[model samples]
Target: MSGSDVRMSAWGAVGLVAGREVSTRVRSKAFLATTGVTLLVLVAFTLVMKFLGGTGGADATVGFAGQTSVLEASLKATATSVGQEVETRAVADEARGREQVSDGDLDALLVGDGTSIQVVVKEELDAELRTALTVLAGNIELNQQIVDLGGDPGQVNQRVSQAAIDVRPIEAPRDFNGEQMVLGMVAGILIYMSLLINGQSVAQGVVEEKSSRVVELLLATIRPWQLMAGKVLGIGAVGLLQMGVIGGVGMGLAMAVGALTIEVSAAVGTVVWLVVWFLLGFVAYSLVFAALAALVSRQEDVGGVIMPPLLLVILGYVLGISILPGDPGNRLVEVLSMVPLFAPMLMPMRLAMGGVPAWQAGLAVVLVAALIPALVWLSGRVYRNAVMRSGAKVKLTDALRSA
Candidate 1:
């Protein structure tokens, strides 16, 4: 920056600083390395999910022996009706089928020449498979009884199959989509990594300049808040771009690979929300990080200064990742996600889970948005007061009081 830069307006100074940061960091090898690593990880994940069949693996494998081969399709349909995916294979005879089951080639084997459904398992039967088999056996018995009574067994079974209870739910329950759950989880991981990594980039940048006394030189031209805001905005822009690329490319790969079978709109919505929350979370956390980092001129002490807020980020992510997958309606996580401090990590995950009320999502965004101005004022004061004073770690009270 030149001496004439001191005479520039605040916007001009900030733009100049921001421009410098963007140009410098975007060209750096660290940025390239991290972005490359992230993209590779995404590609690997997409491929793995595609190969593994995208959140639906066979619940069990069943082998049909002898004349039981005719029963394979009905058995599969029955398993599916009970929310199980049972893959079936043919065996030459009951002896071979039992051997396959014992050798773990199949989860269960059907035997006894298809007169009735008989299963042999190496161990105990799975509860789900048991339910499906019980239902199948009941249908068979009912058909036999109808045949003995001279009724059309097929017509009677069809009527029985069509019987469904009239469900009168007061409010419709949200059916969590498989794709949404996976997408939400991926969203959480992406945002958490972004905030932890890029948020620190903001702080480390501040400490590096201060420790190197480069801040003093820069300050000669630009005002303190302008310098601070420029750093945040500049780094933020780069991070946002990087994040957008990862989210877009990851979603695209999943879609192309058939791993994400959801509608394009849902996938696009997830990416958009990911970007939105990232901006909000990044700005909110970066402001505080930049301010706290100003208190300590050394890179090592930056961690000490930022640990409290860092824990909040980690806590939010942990709660979201651990609990939300099991119980997306977790009350505590729901309430905490509404808090601005935790919203960045948790809200995006819940949003990706695909059933959040419109008001709730809007409120979380609004809360975080409202908190940004307060952070700007508070962070600006500490950054301004402490950025110029470098040496031993400055007390938080002194930074605030002196300002």
Candidate 2:
């Protein structure tokens, strides 16, 4: 009987093939090593960032000359408030202050000149010191003005120091912050890696099967599409499980480090979104990779033939972390997010950075979802013809040309 005539149900065939693929790959050493290493690196990076400390707490030493008691007090108080350590030393003269700063003995030196102040630094003043000095100078000038206008400088200073501005946005998205950016990046990287790694897994599997004549044996009972679908599904299942581990570990690590605090509902929703996109991206790219691999008989040739799709994945990721982080509203990002090849990577990035309308995300989903079956059908046709061919690499045009 023909393979198709004797084959079990389509779902059964695909599942049988998928099951085999999953079992084989999961047991492989490379998958285990890479997954463990990736998780370790994730944990290591988070711990490093958490314990490394931020820009605050660094010491800034300032040398002063002439009458500057008020400015020195203001500087010390400001630095303390902003979590900066400022050390002040009395210099005999301006020349001595400059010498101290030039000799690296002081970060900066302030010289009182009548009502104005001049600062000397070896290079540029440190940002914390600069801010403190500016505030101090402004307050001094304001106090002089208040005293000249027959008002109490001390009372004005108290009122000014107590005043603060609170900002409230009229229409803001739900608490999207630096933590969300990190999570979004993690999501994008996960998708990119899965697509690049598992998609290539499909390609390499195709090339290996063809090279060893395994395709002929497998094709004995199942159709070409079934084989392709099973491989993609099986490998994608492995990818999904790997992604779940990575995502869970990442979320747990982030929370453990106090870097991220997310609502249970929102966290669950994000996880769902990530899984959905990963499946879509895997299906979209895996079929194409498998079809492309079928055109090349050698493993080495897989990389050369897969350049186009690989570039698309790279471009999407590059845009995701770089441009999307800064300008989520960029015309290019908006345009690309709707395209099937780039949407899986960019749409999550956009959603994470906030300001993306529900419809735009929905539209991107609809477009990519609508395109997968068509892609599967087309890729299956290419694979059916190309898998049987051997020797020279099959041109895409030649593969698509119906016999």
Candidate 3:
């Protein structure tokens, strides 16, 4: 066979092995069950957040005294504007309102004494209700001042209208603060969790193959690089499929429940970037994990092999959290976000929060992409050297020297 034919056959063999591994994993019941559970939890949490955001309406009882029916109507209108459903009760006197407030019969009592207003809440009143009462009182006072200055109530109402703010996200297209934070946290968690889960799987698979003396038999049929590449790709494919299913279900549920108000186009773009970043991050980490796995001949040595990668993931997560609330343009943050190991966590967050410039984000992506080939080359050398060595755990320095 020609050299070209040999290369093609080798690649074909690698693809077949990868396909077999992916098929085996996908057929496992654990995979299906875990994906379903993840989808359900994501949907349920999103719905709960929507429910808690006053989408279902409030059930607070408010008492009013020393104000006419017109004033009560105005108060109700003001409360409704702030997403509160005020069940207004006209008290016979301020004393009666105070008594109701104290007796737990009312959430709050509003006493308007001409120019001054007092809001009385029970010690057990809901914190949200108390805050809303304060806000409503301020609105009332502002309206009174407008009227005192001969300003029309209609004009004041127009001036004080609270409309929904439409968010046009530049990089990551989350519609609200909840969605932005949720997506960022979820992305970071998935990166960390996937690395741990799949990395362990790779290590355990290697140990099992080694302990069972299957590696010697397999080595006769395929090259070591092909074996390693096939395993990594297959497991990476499984991870991607699981992530895609969960993400699609989540997006649909979010839209259905009105938890997400962003445009579908924008959401799709964000998911595309997520998948792109996941692939890059997984490839980089999984190769290192597989190389680490090959360094140990026994299952007992797996922890020592995997600890460094796990620690790196944890450090990235901590750094991502700390930088999330600050300006992403800070010198340290920019440097960390560009580092390939930390980029998966920090870059996604910075993108979501509109923290990173487009050029910087592109540059970070390019840097990560450039680093992958070097990592792959290094990991391939480590795996070839250590996979055949049968003994105590191999040191990282020895693996590098072997390269």
Candidate 4:
């Protein structure tokens, strides 16, 4: 009986192929090792950020000698106001404080007659530390001047501290912060790795089947597009599982350890958007990968055949990684992010950073969504025409022109 006249339905054939791919891939040692290493790194990072010493420690340590210890609170407040964390320690005397500074135990030593701020450093103070000390020194002079002029130092200092510059922005962002920016970069990394790994997996799988003459036998029972679709969907399903596990576990662990100060909902939202973009990007890119891969029978030829589409993936990732972390709202990046080719990698990063308009996000999704059907038709044609023609690289023109 002919393969088409067999008992199985078309969907059944696709499912069988997909199931085989999923079973084969998940059993591989490389997948298990990579996933395990990723989890361990995520967990280790969370631990270090929360419990172990990370950036949470003070930036500089200042030693106070004698009566200068009275200025501890004020000096610390000044440093904190400028986003510098200063740890204050009491010293027995100027001699000991200088010793500590020289030994690098203290960043600077504060020693004076309690009348003004004085600093002794091993060499020069850090620029940020210098800024903090300068502000504190100026405040001391201003306070003493106020006292001599018969004005209340406390009241004057309070007013000066309360004063702040007011700025009015033309357009306010919907939601954006340092935390969100970090999440955006993480999202970009996850999507980029996912696309690169899984897309290449599809290509290699295609070339492997073709090079081994396995495609001939598979085509005897299943249609070319079904086999291609099944492989893509199957590998994508496994990759999606990996992405969810890694993202969900990492973010969940970060939240659980209190390492992440952002709202829980924000973290969850980032994970959801990450998964969405991965799915969109994988399906979109893998189609082209499979098609291009079919043009090459040998595994060695796969890279060259797939380089053009691979460049698109790399370009989107590079642009998003390079630009979004610094300028989330670059006009060029924002515009390119809307294009279907770039949307899969760039849009997710933008979404994590927030301030992406609802309409714009929706439109990017729609654009990529619209591109898939065209890819399916075009890619299916190339794969069908080229998959059975082994031993030499198939030209695109010939693939397209074949009946």
Candidate 5:
């Protein structure tokens, strides 16, 4: 056969092997059942969160005494603005209001003495209530100061209005407060688990094939690189499919519970980045795993061989969590997020949190994409050199020499 014909034949064999692996995994009952169970669990968790938040809002009851019509009106408006239906009760006296609060009949008591305002609660007030009251009190105090200083109320109001500047976001703005945290956490967990599960499958498959001598028969028809590529592609396909199902279920639950809100568009963009990065990360890790698997004839040595990549994955996750609450634009965070190994976890998080510049995100993705080919080439060389050897355990030096 001519060189081109030989290359075409090899590519065809690789496609066939990959196709078989994909088909086998897709058709497995285990995959279907796991997907179904996971979807149900996610839906249940979303429902629980929604119910808890709803209940928390419903449980607050505030009493007001000695408050003027203006103060009451302002409090009501503020509560309405934040989507809270405050249970506002008019109390005849401060003593009664404080008594009700102490007895738990009222969550909090708002007392206005004309010159000063006080909030009396059983203990800690609801966070939402506290925030609303604080803003309202600040406005009231400012207006009083303007009147006391002989300034026109209209002019004071205009100054206050002008002081309220629109908060322009430096990065792409997200509509939801905590959506980035949820998205980053979910994506990181999924990627970490998928890598560990799928990489182990690749290692086990290699060990099993070798132990059963099936690899010898397969090698006659396919090159080591083709076998490795097929396994990686097949498993990668399965991982993507699983992630798609999870994403669909999560989106559905979010929408059902109003968690999606205006942030759905942002979340969709994050997921797109997640899938792209996941593919690159999987290839980098899986190739290394496949190569390591080839170093041992027995399945037992697979764990030890896979340790370095696993440790890297763990470290990435730990660092991602550590830096999440801090400035994502910090030099250390930026450096970590751009590195190929940690980019899979950190870049997605930084993107979701509105921390990364567009150019930096683009550059990080490109850098990771560029690393995959080098990793594949190195791993293929390692596999070809070590797969045929029978040994207790192959040292890295020996493997490199053989390669």
Candidate 6:
């Protein structure tokens, strides 16, 4: 028999469609270009962050005069206590100190005569520097008072140094820190982009097939739902593969560069959650895109019909990245994390923050999982009726009624 006359199993047909989609799109220049560009951007971003600075101790250069030894020692000790490093230069000439400070050779110029201290800067001093100077001044005054009261400052300092306080936690939190926060934000972005880009691809593909009269030939052999399912599944598989590569490579690069400071287990967990949410988010949006795109016979009308799904994705992304970071425990965030429409974005963020209870996360999964079947049923109905119509645009109401 000819290719068109051959009878194929339902699974076989879907696989054929999916394989066709994967091969065609994955080999396309557009796909490779976008992936390459994203990898480059991620690498560049990591480099920029490293170049800006890491969590290493702060450093400052200071020039001092007039009884500089004791005061310099005090400043160094204070700064060192706070994980800061201060380099001291004894400038005997005040004029030379001022000129060096003006020329950017010194962060600040300190003029002290035992009991009193003065700091001169070309411009406003940073809070760290100001704090270091303030601490040095206080220590000098304390020493003077101790001497006046017939006490030894060294003995007092030695005694205070040996005193320490212990802190205990009633309930220890999960390992959520700056690196984990970054990982979470990255996951959210991946979800948003996966749904947005691949959903649009599905819509555009559906519109193209209809406009070109390709669906009629395919529908002659396979049912409409199978075609729709095949298309979404195929495109979504591509998206999943892309997301996996991006997540793996991005995390690997981050760890290699010391950008990701979280532990290995945490990183692996973050990646696992990212993949799960990506699948959930992609499936939720792709079918909706296919159904909506059926209403349009041409590529030009695709944008106007897909607004609702697009808006939902954008809203979720905004909430995930913007408000959720600063206020992960906000009542609104907690509520949204359980909502099917917003869960894909918000849930991952709450997970990253590490305070979400198991029940809440399971509930979110159940809600999102439940919505998929209903959406699939509705979109399948829409696709069956509208996939055949040609020429003018079809209304969603008419599509549902006719189906």
> Backbone collision count in every prediction?
0, 0, 0, 0, 0, 0
TM-score of each: 0.88, 0.79, 0.77, 0.89, 0.81, 0.85
lDDT of model number 2: 0.85
Runs of candidate 1 with Cα error greater than 4 angstroms are: 1-6, 54-73, 87-114, 118-131, 146-152
Instruction: Report the number of the highest-lDDT candidate.
Output: 1
Cα lDDT listed for each candidate: 0.91, 0.85, 0.75, 0.89, 0.79, 0.85
lDDT of 4 by residue, 1-403 (tens): 7767747788888899999999999999988998999899878877887775345589999999999988999999999989999999999999988988989999999998767878899988899999998888888898899989999999987897799999898998565787688778878888989999999999999999999999999999889999999999999999999989999998888777777788878788888888888888899999999999999888888899889988998998899899877778898889988999999889999998988988888999899989999999999999999999987789998998887
Across residues 9-54, which tens digit of lDDT does each residue of candidate 3 receive?
6777678778987999899997888888888888888788778764
Per-residue lDDT for 223-242 in model 5, tens only?
99999999889888998889
Which digits, one per residue and each the tens of the lDDT, describe model 1 over residues 35-136? 999999999988998888855668998988888887788888899998898889998888988899899989898887665779999999989999988888
After superposition, the stretches of candidate 2 with alpha carbons farther than 4 Å from their true spots are 1-7, 53-127, 152-176, 262-266
Candidate 1 overall lDDT versus native: 0.91
Clashing pairs in 5: none
lDDT of 6 at 57: 33
- Assess candidate 1 and give its TM-score to the true structure: 0.88
In candidate 2, the residue pairs with backbone N, CA or C atoms under 3 Å apart (3 or more residues apart, or in different chains) clash, namely none
Global lDDT for candidate 5? 0.79
Question: Residue by residue across 1-403, what tens digits does model 6's lDDT show?
Answer: 6768867899888888888899989998988988889989988988776666575434789998766655777888988886678889988778889999999889888875656778879898978878877887788788889999999999998998899998788866445466656767888888888888898999999999999999999999898888988888889899888888888898888888987767788778877887788788888888899999999898999999999879988998898788866765678878988998889888887786677889999999998889999999999999999999998888889999993
What pairs collide in candidate 4?
none
Q: Where does candidate 6 clash, by residue pair?
A: none
Task: Arrange candidates, best TM-score first.
Answer: 4, 1, 6, 5, 2, 3
lDDT of 2 at 61: 88
